[model samples]
Target: MPMTVGALRETAKGERRVALTPETARKLVARGLAVIFEHDAGREAGFPDATYVAAGATPADAADVAARADLLLCVQLPPADRLTALRAGTAIVGQLRPNAAHDRLEALGERGVTAFSLELLPRTTRAQAMDVLSSQAAVAGYRAMLIAAEAAPMFFPMLTTAAGTIRPAKVLVIGAGVAGLQAIATARRLGAQIEGYDVRPETREQIESLGARFLDLGVSASGSGGYARELSAEEQAAQQAALGERLRVFDVVVTTAAVPGRPAPKILTAAMLEGMKPGALIVDLAAESGGNCVATVPGQRVNVGGVTVLGPLDLAAGAPLHASEMYARNLLNFAGLLVRDGGLSPDFADDLVAATCVNRVGEKQPQLI
Candidate 1:
């Protein structure tokens, strides 16, 4: 019998992305794999059960897929009840933040489930196509500008009309990672005169390459492995002071700075928020990790005087269709490392696979055995 891989509807609050899209399901089925998905798994993402069936996938409830599947594809950790029902030796893959889910990790290990958390994938050329963080950051970054344009009372583009000529909205985007770059590009496309800021001086080229004027606050915290180092207290104070003075001009500020597995660095302070122009907008993409702004409440819109600050949770889920497509493609590429000729016989020593799997594969994964 062919190896069966299945996905269930995400139970995470406000999550709409599904691990399996009809397109990816068809590709997996073409590889001689059996695709199973819970009923309504992709419905929220605008795909129906009929679409999965057309792609050669079987429609099953969560309980049925739990019992019958050899592997589970997911976006978040499966629900506790679903986890309890999973067969011993089944493999699970997703952005399972192992640190925050210590008890769940131990539980999966005890049940001999091979848990693969895609977020742990190493930074390498081989892993780029399967980098969920990068793909999803693209979604979040693009959405940030859309949110800013909508929430801001002012128009994004300059206008010349019988009424006076209005200047373009000034947007300053903080951070230069995938999300930050996308935010700059999207804001520019919306006709906003935008600038991008990052703690890493090396990113000036990347930010400017996207047609955005790079904002330099005279702070650099470049770190190894393409990530920024945490700023020291003295440097943080200098950065905040420099940044607060500049916040008054920009009509829209978007903060995308984040460190994986760490609380988001406090970039926008209460003082900075208070100094921004009245009727301005601040969109914090790092809100899920406690926000880059001291004033932002994760998943809520807050009013600081007349300025609007939004900590949008699951912003990618807000654009579910394309987000799910990109997410499923990333997962499908990563799936190549695990599923072999219609069965699971992954090489445990493979760097990409070894870096992601958080639990022992037991005997089902012959390489681990």
Candidate 2:
């Protein structure tokens, strides 16, 4: 008999993406996995109950889906209440933030449920298909640039019109990760004069490849995990001074610096905002984990020294349909690696799964908190 997999309705506030779509359900069915999904799980994201039914999945209630599932899949981490429904030995896969919610992970471990966090997948060439963070951040970066462009008073492209020639906006992107690189490319496509800064000296080629000048502050604070490491107070001061000096010339700034388990580093100070041209715009993508800008308030827009700062939370949720599609593909790739021969065979020996799996293994205690 095949293992039973369930897709529960997303309970996270403002999260509309379903864990599985009808098309994905059909693929699982063909692979000999029984699928059960809560009725209307995908409705808000434009997939209807009838669609799942046509794809050979049973439309179940939330309780039934949770009770019957041998494996549960979700977009966000399950809430405390939902975690209570899992049977011992049940496997759960999703974007559970273990670093941010160690207590919740401990609870799941106590319940004897195997949990996997998609974000912890290593950035290896073999794991590219399962790279949810990069895929989602790509969309976020593109959208953030558009948001900044719209909010700014000046035009992104230089226009030689009959009335007068409008100068192109200057855009500065901090952090040359997936989001930052996408922001630079998107801004350049809009004809903006783009410049990018990063603690990783290796990203200089990447920044220049996107037609953006790479701003170097002579810092070597990047980590082995290919992320920006925390900087020393003295190094931070030098970075701040260099960044503040550049702020005065840029018409739009987008900050994407973030450390997964820690608060976002403050790269833009209040004084930096003061130096920005009047009516300038700043989009801080790290708002949810504190912000890259000191003035940023998550999910709110603030004005400082005549400059507009937008701290948008869950930018991926803003584009539900496409976001769901990309996320679903990532999950499917990950599941494919673990599920084989009509049963769950989570290969702990596999590097990708070993790095991503976060819950208790066998009788061992959880690795996190």
Candidate 3:
């Protein structure tokens, strides 16, 4: 019998992205994998039931699909209760944040379900096609600038009229990563004069290539996996002292610095916020992991000293169509490692499979966590 894979509609609050898309589903079917999806699974992402059908997928309610499939794909970790219903040994795959969901992860092992967290995929050229974090961060970065522009009182670009000339909005983007670079590019397109900052010195070239000046704080923390290593207390204090003063000069500030599986470091302090001009905007893309700003409330917008601080959650979902498409491609490529010749292969010897597999066949791999 062909291996069956199913997708459930995401139940996470404000999550609109679907793990499967019509195009990806068609590709899976072409590989002789049985594709099943919950009814209306793709609706929120602008894909209709008819679209999935045309792409050769079966649609049914969650319960029916859950019982029959040997594997399940999801946008986020599905709720514990829904996971409990999956048949034992079914492989579950998605961007499961195991660090935060330790309890639910244990529950999956207890239920005898094999779980794979794509977030654990090793940073390798072979795994680039399955890089969900980079794909989604790119979307969030582009949207962060739009959110800042909409919330700011002044226009992004300069203007010349019968009245006196208006200067372009000055923007600062912290974290010269995929998201930060995108934010810088987007802000520039809107005619804003933008600058970027990062703890890693190597990113200066990437930032400058995007037409934004790189703000160097005279410290470097380059780390493995292309991520900045955690800064020491002395380094953090130095960075804060220098950054707080420079932050006051920008009309808009976007902070995207985040370390996976850890609380986001506080980059903007209350004193710094007090120094900003009235009506200046700060968009914290790290809101979900605590936030880059001290005052940030996840999923809420707050006003501090007349300056607006916007912390958007699930920013990728705000632009779900393309987000879902990119996410689905990543999932399809990752799943190919598990499915072979029309049935489950479950080869842990494969580096990509070994790194991503959290639990398999009722055994929890604590070392991987």
Candidate 4:
């Protein structure tokens, strides 16, 4: 018998995307897996119940789908009450934030469910198709630049008109990772003068390659995995001083500095905000993780001294259709790699699986809190 794959409706508030798309469901079915989905799971994301059915997936209630599934696919961490629905030995895949959901992961493990966190997917050529973080971050980066542009009082491109000449907006991006690089590229396309900074020295070239100037602090602050490490108190002070002096020059700043599983490092202090020109704009992409700017409030916009600071938490969700498409592609790639010969296999020896799987084998409780 073929193994069963199931997708549940996202229970998280404001989540618009289903874990699987109808197109992906059909592809999975062709690969010999029976696909099941919660009724109306894809409706909000623009995929209808009839669409999934047309694609060869059976629509069922959440509990029934979970009960029959050999592999459970979700867009977010499973809710506590839903844990009871998962059958023993089921393989689950989703954006299970292990640091935040450690207890829930432990519970899933206790229930004998093998749970995988998509965020832990390794950055490698072989795993590119399965990289959920990069897919979502690409959407976020594009959105962040647009948001910053909208919040700015002036236009992004320079204009020479009969009335007067308008200067182009100046943008500074404070990270050179996937999101930061995308922001730089987007801003440049809009005719803005863009500059980028990152703790990882190697990213300087990547930033320059995007037609953005690279801003160097002349200090080493990167950690393993090419992420920016936490700065020492004195180093942080010096960095802040340098940023403050430069802050007044830029018309818009998009900060994407964040360390995974940790609070966003404070890059723009209150004093720095005060130094910025009146009507300047700041978009903090790391707002969900506390924020890269001191005054940023997650999901809210604030005005500090005459500068508008926006901290949007769910940027990808704001662009639901495309975001869902990208996420479904990544999830499909991951599931295809793990399932073989008509059944799901938890190959702990595989680097991709081992790094992403958080639960131990043969447990009966949730491990993600």
Higher-ranked by TM-score: 2 or 3: 3
Clashing pairs in 2: none
RMSDs, each prediction? 3.2, 2.1, 1.7, 2.3
Model 3, position 12, has a per-residue lDDT of: 89
- Runs in model 2 deviating more than 4 A are 361-369
Model 3 ranges off by over 4 Å: 361-369
- lDDT tens readout by residue for model 1, 1-369: 889989999988889999999999999999999999999999999999999999999998889998888888999898779867788778888888877885687678788778888888887999999999999999999998999999999899999989999999999999999999999999989999999999999999999998999899999999976789888999999999999998899999999998788888888888887888899899999999999999899989999988899999888898999999999999999999998767887788898998887766342321110
**Residue by residue across 174-288, what tens digits does model 3's lDDT show?**
9988899999999999999999999999999999998999998888899888888888999989988898888878999999998777789898999999999888999999999
- What would the per-residue lDDT of candidate 4 be over residues 1-369, giving only the tens digit for each residue? 789999999989888977899889999999988999999898888999999999999999988988999998888987878758888989889898888887788878888888889888777889899988888888899999998888789999999999999999989999988899999999999999999998778898999999999988766686776576777888888888887898889999999987667788888988999899999999999999999999999999999889999999888887878888889989999997689778887677788888888878553322321
Tell me the lDDT of model 3 at 248.
78
List model 2 lDDT by residue over 257-337, tens digit each. Answer: 886667888888888888888989999999999999999999999999899999998888777788888888888788987
Worst 10 residues of 4 by lDDT: 360-369
Clashes of each: 0, 0, 0, 26
lDDT of 1 at 89: 73
What's the C-alpha lDDT at position 366 in model 4?
26
* Reference-based lDDT, residue 227, model 4: 72
lDDT of 2: 0.86
